[model samples]
Target: MKRYLFIMSLIALLGACAKKEGKFDRADGTAAITVASLENHLKILASDAFMGRMPFTEGEQKTIAYLQEQFKNLGLESGNGSSYLQEVPMVEITTTAAPVMEVKSAKKKFTLEGLKDYVIWTQRTDPTTEVKDTELVFAGFGIVAPEYNWNDYEGLDVKDKVVVVLVNDPGFGAEDVSLFKGNTMTYYGRWTYKFEEAARQGARGILIIHDDVPAGYGFWVVQNSWNASKLYLDTRGKDLYFSAFTGWVSQPAAKKLFEEAGIDWASTVSAARKPGFKAVPMKLSITTSLVVKAKYDKSHNVIGKITGAKQPDEYIIYSTHWDHLGIGKPDEKGDTIYNGALDNASGTAGMLELIKAFKNMENKPNRTVVFLAVTAEEQGLYGSEYYAQNPVYPREKTVANINMDGINPYGRMKDIVVVGIGQSDLEDYLDAEAKAVGRYTSPEPNPVAGYYFRSDHFNFAKVGIPALYTNTGIDHHEKGADYGKQLQDEYVSKYYHKPSDEYDTSRWNLEGAAEDLQLLFNVGKKLAFETSWPQWKKGSEFKSTREQYMPKVN
Candidate 1:
């Protein structure tokens, strides 16, 4: 009897050990992240052989092929009807330099170089466009916000005239906290909105004065972008609305324009802030013409979906921008390819991994999981904007959008930066998942730069869907925050918006990346199963939109 009991006890002990091992095994119902798999994807996506993955180029074809192949292998269904690619209509606008941009003031005249001190471009469909001697009006901020009861163009007729405006808004310089959040930029401050509003007001031309802090990047960024071929959605379907000429003026050039009008440039800006401010006529006129060739082409937004068994209609989305700055002028090293490895390729790879993990799960999620790699994000979130406007899944059914833009190539940090914090309950999900891996959430380091409005996720947020755009934490384990800041500074100064942003495995540490991916997965899994739909926190601009679409749960 004693011998029999000993044998049974030994067998039981062995069984317990096997169960423990199985609990931790990724292939056996465990949540294990394969960093090697992620690295392999990034290496291929960011490779020089990929030719920088620019839209409308050879690189775009290669990149899309690889993505489709991976999705097929992973067993995800095509998101579009009978296809993985969603065709997006685009118009490539290539403008040639006119003789010069002639500016005539009361007593002086100035000629601005085409691509040197100033860069001008337009999106109007007109083949032959000219702004001949339009009056210049200095409109402070050039914003009209019903919420704030502020309008710079309240009583001015800006039709067929040039509107010169500040880069950000009056809220940026306001002293009170209740006024536009005091220095935190709202959507009205974005350059896109500025130009769109100007077009709505029937302006002949719109010129924004560039300031480094407010515009986020330096004047060099704008110069580089304007020098390259610009792309926009075809105006054939939608009405094309824009000023005849839309561009930027450097600080000194703007000051010169103001000085030519015999107006104190600094004092005039100060005076424009008060109530009942009128448009200041600089007594100046801008004369410019453009010879533009319009070519309509089709781009794509790649989408793959894993349909849920119980709740096939409800969905959680994982998105990243696949497009980067296409081939452009060579850099100092004579390399014309902008690899955009960290800028977005890393984030794209992360989304691929998340898709794989969801596909591998034994107990399938309750809601469908959608992975979208959008095009033309580098051009200003155009692809995602189009998706938001025309969604494959209903906006009311989209539970949440987890967007990854620039992932950390460096090692792990303590706190992950959450852009547009305090906007949604999605942060609660992220906080719990991150704590599981000894990580925490933090707000954006530079809120004043308006990083929240700079990415594709902003489009979804605009339509009332709760969106989370989180970057790798900054408090590194080895080098701490200072070291992390150093890496960021290097990227911003040297490779950002340049051709040197190619991938290098020697410097990249994807451990932190894998951690963040796991955290995002956990968030999606929770949302997929939960009964309640996540809502924007009170006071958020998207709150009303969310309330309108969310299902009434009694």
Candidate 2:
């Protein structure tokens, strides 16, 4: 009997030592990711049958079911207490444009054609949204940041007025590192923020002047993206605090308006950067009409979990947005489905692939890992926003979030792009994993684009959870940097958000995506087992929120 007990003790010791060695410390790549498997998943999720996976549509039902099935197949438990789905109520608004925006200046009148000179939409739930000759005030930058002691609306009541604002902030133009985090675009620089701030300031409408350098993309991107049906979380009669109209104008249109007002465009741009800059009334009124068709319904956030062996309540989240633009206006070739293959179907597949990797582990993690596929990312990140507000897991017990969106489909990269690189200690974790694969981590080439605030991870970050958002590197291993840049530029011009975004197996290199998935997996794997909570870097906007919500280590 004593001999039998000794043998059992010996077996237990070996198991404990094996666990310490790390179940994820395998050199074989198959355990983490595989190219063929990833490609197979992508083919189905981004196929035409999915119909672009639009929220509140049949595509959404198919997407949610497929995700749930994938999770169940992987043997992962439902994240939301025996239910893999979290219902998110949403409102869809399709605004029909009037083709022309009539501007009545004090001197004369001019008309700007839609899809050519400007694009307009409305967030208000009202069926008819019309701005009839509303006063146009050139609210320089339209920012009211007290940290910089700058208020463009000072002594200017923009209530019932249309505020024409510049895209991005003055710091980006001046390259003054002392002002507004230098060339790095802050939340204030985002167009979404501008519209929200305008609403808060009681503005009837907000129009952003689009310049390539400041807006990071061409006017065509704005035109194509805005000329569609938009989705938002249903406020359920709650005050949404949104402007009647939020839109953009071409640089030429903006210049024409400024010229008509006798305000030198160049001088106004320079003066807008100066301290104590005040709002200038352009003596112009914008007139436009919008007819909106609205629908309210419930969407789902598919959540699955690998509950921790020790701390079941504490969680580390892996997220990807699943919904895309759906079927929209047909392109010149008659292709109407916006198969968001790379935009997000790739990310969602990455989440599932990573979950499979974790499930294959010999030893379970100490903290829970939540694999969440959210909806309505194309419609302003509403799905993730709902999850953050009504989280199944308390924010205090949440450890970190690793988000994958628009990963590399080209080829293996020499480096990885870290979006908002200096935001948190999560960078160190990712850097370590990336280096293991002989790849270096670099900050995103275009920090001024504000790509950080544009993804699902931002919603998690906003609630003070440390989140990591990165993309596949721009420097391809064989094609080199110029080739990488050319591919990216081509996508932005020809494919992004268009029906051309459909998946083409011949054009893709799955090995690169597999590499990214492995790197992200390593980051989350380390966080799940480690006893420490990663914190936002000093001076980060979300740092205080982390300090507030994270459980005290006393």
- RMSD of each candidate relative to the true structure: 6.3, 3.9
Clashes by residue pair, model 2: none
lDDT (tens digit, per residue) of candidate 2 on 41-99: 88899999999999888999999999999999999999988899999998878988788
Off-target runs (Cα >4 Å) in candidate 2 are 1-32, 96-119, 129-135, 146-149, 154-156, 224-227, 250-265, 281-289, 328-336, 479-483, 500-503, 539-541, 544-554
- Residue 94 lDDT in candidate 2: 91
lDDT of 1 by residue, 36-62 (tens): 888898889888888888878898899
TM-scores, each model vs. reference: 0.87, 0.86
RMSD of 2: 3.9
How many clashes show up per model?
A: 0, 0
- Runs in model 1 with CA error above 4 Å? 1-32, 101-118, 173-176, 256-264, 274-278, 281-284, 326-336, 497-500, 544-554
Ten contiguous residues minimizing lDDT sum, candidate 1: 21-30
